[model samples]
Target chain A: MAGLLRRDMLGVALTVAAIMLPVAGAQAADPIKVGVTITQSPPGSVVQGTQVKDGLEVAAKIINDAGGVDGRKIELVIEDTQGLPEKARAAVEKLATRDKVVAITGEHQSSAALAGIEVAHRYKIPYINTNGWSDVIREKGYPEVFNPGNYNSRVGAAAAATMKELGVKRVVSIAENTDYGIGLAKAIGEALKKIAPDVQYKYETLDRASKDFLPAILPMRANAPDAIINLMLPPAAYIMMNQLYEQGVAPSAKTWLYDGSGLADYPDFWQNVKEAGKGMLVFGLYHPKMAQPALGKQVGEAYTAKTKNEPNRLLFQAADSLFLIADAIKRAKSTDSGALIKALGETKYTGTRGEITFSKDKGYAFNQWLDVPYVTFQLTEVNQKVGDSALVSQAGQPLDPAKLWKPAK
Target chain B: MSGIDVDLAVNGLITGVFYALMAIGLSLIFGILKIVNFAHGEFYMVGAYAYTLIALALGVPVWIALPLAFVVGALLGWLTERTLMRPLYAGYTSWGLMRDEYAVIVTFGLSLFLINFVDKVIGPYAYRGPPLVETSRVVLGPVLISGHRLLAAGIAIAVIAVTAALIKWSFWGQQIRAVSQNRLGASLAGIDTAKASVIVFMLSGGLAAFAGALLSPVINASPDVGIFPAIKSYIIVVLGGMGSVPGAIIASLFLGVIESFGAVYISFQYRDAFGLILLMLFLLFRPQGLFGEKGREV
Candidate 1:
């Protein structure tokens, strides 16, 4: 009787061990899903979307090649928002519930980002803003949302400082009718008021849909400002720049053409602007001359090798976005939403650009990678590459006016 | 007037010429079908792409490419009428039997399809057309205009004159007018009413496409490039008295000058608003429009 009882106990223990081990193994091997929302069609900036998509894909490949995080692959579930607010909201909802992604990232447009964050907050999912520069995104103070790219206030201060250094008393910003464009335009105005009190500044908001801006541009001919700042995205920015050049408005000896939209890095810049881009000062987010981590070089080289086009700032920002998510997952040791959010908040990961860490402070600084580096450069010749352009200002440094160029009328 | 005002007026008139070209086609479509072609903008977009690609990509001369673009647009217009638009008036003996709602739904759907088709196939990139002239800048008294724009405006005037003449005096022109006035009566009088409808669509398509090709140099061609022009065309069609080609021409010029001057004197931001205000004022006071006759036939 005693031997029979011992045999029954041994058999039950063996059965339990066999069932539990395989379940744990399957869980460990399952891929972790991340969500990406970007514009892939018209009425939105497709160029930005294509760049971000390429960047994320490159980073995903790098991670998988490095055996991924804890031996599980990072799978991206992408949705095309077309840069519409309603589309973005639905995309986040689908990503969180249907795709069951651990986190959401790669939103480049500010208006889309604003809509996306609401859904992320509702679902308590982690959202990393890749390129949406509007300060209002960070100002909302949503715990789930984080920004690791450039912000409007940063640009506003930088632009104000540059204007002061150039000693331009009168400035005009031809802004596109969008959150990013108008926000930066207003931010610059505020910054100018504080830092360069004597400088005269005003901004004209143009409909993004309207192709003709001659009316707004022609009036400036009679009383041309000292500097004309572009606060619009291409191809609208390209159109505006060409129109400005055609009207003898800027890049001339008397007036400087300052690009606040970081338009120089776009692949189609020279193709669209041609001679109009010459002698223009650019607010560059990623210059080839700037110091970056080894990962940055890897991603940039991979992007060029794949696309056969030079790397832009959006690539590094997008790569860093994905890397931050993967790093958070590894640190948390789980794919649970609460754990992922907590891990992301406490992240201090070395990414493609630099050692990225979220800020604990409130307002625009909260959960933002505050020290995103930038540089100022000048396009001295038509069809000049961003790498070949002269860097007039380095990260955290003032612009050197002597290094700048203006076309002689 | 100051030099700036003179410059504004000159630019306004030039713009008006292009607007007249676009509006004439839309007016013709409305006159014949009594339903506005919602896809009128896509026709323009197609022409812009055709001209740009033919000249820059295929190494064709600008003069040759310009006419070829119009031909392409005319062919597209003909095809659209033969296929999608035929169902609206097919087998229907009278205007009252026609499903007017079908025209709206089909044209709107067609517009969306064409925009997306171009976007996907051609990719969402803007291609700047080659300039008709090599000179970059041309000084015209008080204004500094680009050589391409000045030349394009000249071509636009000639095209408008030719189109107007064709509609007024040509053999096909008289048939189109007769059909537009009374489709059933024109059919009864031995005029092939369907053929006249086809010609109107072709002419409308050709003119709109020509306008697009002309402006491609200034406004780079993208997928949805026709949206703004299409909206303006709607307003112009109404302002000019729905079906009057000459009225369209005059209204186009008037709106252009008002917008140009209003943008400068009143507010640049409200430049579009000025046109809307005019439209509202006209709708309230003169519902029949500048040239449109009062009352609709049941």
Candidate 2:
């Protein structure tokens, strides 16, 4: 009886192996799908969305060209969120449930990212935040969420340090009323309090949808601050800058205009602002003159060739997002959510920008890349390209005020 | 008054001039059809693109480009009326019952289509039209304004005056007023009501487009650039009295000044809220508006 039972168990084990091996082989041949949520329509930052989409496409191409991850090609399933939170939530739901993407990434708006992460967390999918800078996103502390791009706290510290070096007594930030804008504004204030406690700082929130900002700008004419930081995105930023110039506010001899929103690298910056952009200082994530990794150089060249436009920070941030996902898949050796999450946490891969590693620390540092490189530059002339702009400061260097330019009032 | 006050007033008035240009068209549409043209803003957007692309891409002079924008808007207005709007009043017996709903849906759909069409076709990047003047700043006492803004404001006044004159005296304008007053009566009196409707739409489109072309330098032309101006125009039309041209002009200036002062004294964040508050109050207490008759029948 014992010999008969042993033979039966052996026969069942052999049958299971025969059934599972072919299914596993077939699955390995299928492409790995990654989900992207971005604004492709009006009322959102379509410019930023387009740049991110282009970067992701370039990265996917490069990955596939290098024989892909274990012979499986990368496929991206994209959805237009139009930069709305509700739409983003629905998009993530659809992608995770219907499309069955392994990992979700490429969200540029903070509100959208915040909404998307909830669904991603619920489904236990790995979520790489591309460019949502709000600190609240980090504070949520979801195990599934990882940030390899810039954050509001990082920019706030940078802006404060630059303001201190410039020796500005009074500074004002004209921030748009959004999670990214308001969070960055508050971050700047907190950083200023630590670095330069005596520096008078305040932020005014403006409606992003409103075209005319003269009313918000007009009062500043009577008492212009030593430095005015622009925390709004275009074309609202462009409108505000023009109005400020017309009202003789900032970028003048008495006041310094600094852009913390990385507006200098936008393709439409010069055409939209024209003379108003001259003499403005910009906080940038990517500069042509800045030293970058070889991967960064390749991505930048590919982006320029593809779009006939200059490489921007969004392009690099977005590329890094995709590369990190591919790297995780390769390390994990499986498309399973738990395995991918574990691999991503342990990642120490060098990406397009630089070495990226997710922080296990709590609060804003949780799952965040803490040491992203940045630079300060000045647009010295009208229609000045980001490459041609004066790089006043590079990563780990103090902003040089002498390198700055002021408009003759 | 303080220098800021002087600056605010001048800026407000200048802003009001542009608002009047947008609101007048909306008012005209409301007068004839008794239904708002939700796509009225797209007319303005089309004009902006027409003026900017004509001048920048085609190398046309800014002066010619500006008027050409108006003509383009008029043509769009004509097309919209002939193709989409004609179904409401022209021989469709079942459609007459759903005229108001049909107008709303059609116009709203047109607005979305135009915005996305422009976004996909022309690309999402914004383009600033060349200013009419090169002078950046022109200071008059405490008021320091941009040369282009001051010039544009002057042109807006002239256009508004001419539009008012034509509407008050022109033969076509009289026919339009007749149709707006009583569509059934006007048709019975051999007023050629369809012709009047077409003319109103064309004129409405032209004015809104002219405003867009004039302000493109200041606002920068983008796909959703028309949305804000459209909202403001709606508020102005209601405050000034629906379908009243003079009321729209007066209400626009009033709202602009109120916003300017309120932004400084009350709160800059609530500046836009002031218009909405006024709109709400008007709807609740006086829905007839400042110049609108409460109820009129043939």
Candidate 3:
């Protein structure tokens, strides 16, 4: 009878061991795959893409090192859109269907983002637009989409305010022939009409793909505008700046070259533009001196360690995108598309830049970070670091003329 | 004319010169091979990268780098003709019915391959080639121009003249002309038609590459930088009369001036459209172009 009892106990222990083995495997859980679409090749701004990728990578490492969200490591599935709309659409579609990413994020170019979001909306996957500034993006009002980055209207308002502060009567905006460039150019004009009615604002749309802007720019030299705002991205922007400077058009005593594209923050800004960048006012989203969250400081430090490059606005935006996605996953307690979207909608997490919260208002503010911090700084000398540059305006502050630098005639 | 008008003309003329350099090569290939080289733009791209990288990375002088870029482009063209173009024409008319379609597919595939290959290898960053002259600006009368632009414009004029003279007087040039007029007849008459095709391709590649190297500083060497120039060259080629070197030069200048003036008075957004519009009008009215022969010669 005792031998029979020993055999039964042994069988019971074996059954328990079998049951616990599967449970332990389930507890480990698979990595939560997130899709990222960025411009990794030409015709798109690869510089921006590289920076965004590094930022996402840095943030992912930090999250995984901290044991990941809800014990599932974050995995970024990056796709190169080549800065083309069709490619972006295809990339998002492939990521959503084939890769089975839990969430999609990291679209930096506005044109590509505009295309990628449509696919994300159709699939009902949560999309966090990292840096597309086009106002039309939010106006689409996709419930699945969230923007924690800069917007065109905010830059428009800031540019208009600066134009008023500088007391410029005539402003010409040379914008790229794209949704971001044209939309932002129009927004600036509207803002100018409301704020400073006396200002004469007219915008010229140049094909971003076309390398030569001399035909468009030469006409400007005959009647130089008070302030020539750059609404284009590099390397086109760099070419335009060089040509303008070579022609003695802007950044002179008579005219101010105000950059609304936040160009100075780019890693290649100084190398490409050289002396032309001097005395040019930049609408900056990030500065070394700006106040950031503890997480922001940590991410910035970690990014510098990884890329050996100074932290820029896109870096913070990209980091915040991943953090928000991770935060949503934690709140939802599941990676279901519907649950993640709901969690992202109610996001109030403190990210790298500030305490992030998305507004539900229509137009530019729809699911957008309404209080995105920005400042206006001018490069006073060649190869000037963002820290060394003079900041003429701070977050929610008027322009300080005393700190503004102008090129001597 | 106002100051802007003169500025537009000068800039237009300079731009036209670059367009002509690119178009001449495409014209030559069409004259000899009777096939549209869709990979022509990539040849320009290769040249731009070659010039920029050699000067920037290898520490070579800009002048030497410019010629080296041309040589690289010529070599690339020769190799492409040998490997890709050889298969298309070998069994072409004698056995195959899809020679035209095959040629299109092969050249198009070659174009995509080169673009992606370079993008992967070099990384997608644009590099500005060092200018021949360090001086930034050179004022001429009322209009102001960059020193590099002025220097490049002069060099282009000289190159075009040399290329035109060579094609008109040289033995190889006469042989290319004969092959273009009657390929079978020329082959029967003891002219090496294949050799003429190879020579045309090399010359074409060299000229396009030279143009790319010259404008690298202004345009900044990127993978897709060739696309814009290639489009302009296509329009100029058709407008000037395909396979007509002089016609390409004249049409390129005309198109450039019209585009410059049109951008200012009409719309800068539609500047590129002007060429397409002119191309359409020419296609409708003058199908043979300014200097093209009335009958198609195979």
The number of the candidate with the highest DockQ is 2
Per-model CA lDDT versus the true structure: 0.90, 0.92, 0.89
Each candidate's interface RMSD (Å, one decimal) is 1.2, 0.7, 1.4
DockQ versus reference, model 3: 0.63
TM-score of 3: 0.94
lDDT of 3 by residue, A223-321 (tens): 899999999998899899999988989888889999999899887677677878999998999999888899999999999998788899999999999
Can you tell me which runs of candidate 1 are displaced by over 4 Å? A1-26
Best by lDDT: 2
lDDT of each residue in B91-184, candidate 2, tens digit only = 5222235357788899999999999999999999999999999898899998988999999999999999999999889998888888877787
Q: How would you class the docking of model 2?
A: high
- Alpha-carbon lDDT of model 3: 0.89
Candidate 1 lDDT, A1-409, residue by residue in tens: 8988899888888898899899989988888899999998877888899899999999999999999999999899999998998999999999999999999999999999999999999999999999999999999999999889999988998889999999999999889888998999999999999999999999999988878788888989889999989999877777788788888888788899989888898887886788889999888889999999999999999999999999999999999999998888888988788898899899888888888888988888888898888888999988899999998997678877876777767
Candidate order by lDDT, decreasing, is 2, 1, 3
What residue runs in model 2 are displaced by over 4 Å at the alpha carbon? A1-25, B92-98, B296-298
TM-score list, all predictions: 0.96, 0.96, 0.94
Clashes of each: 0, 0, 0
- The best-first sequence of candidates by DockQ reads 2, 1, 3
Worst 10 residues of 1 chain A by lDDT: A400-409
How would you class the docking of model 3? medium
Candidate 1 structure quality by residue, lDDT tens digits, B1-298: 9999998998999889889988899999999888989999999999999999999899999999999999989998999999999878987656888998889999999999999899889877788888899677789889999888898899999998998898899999999999888888888899898888899899899988988999988888888889988988999998989988988999999999999999888987788888888899989998778988787667
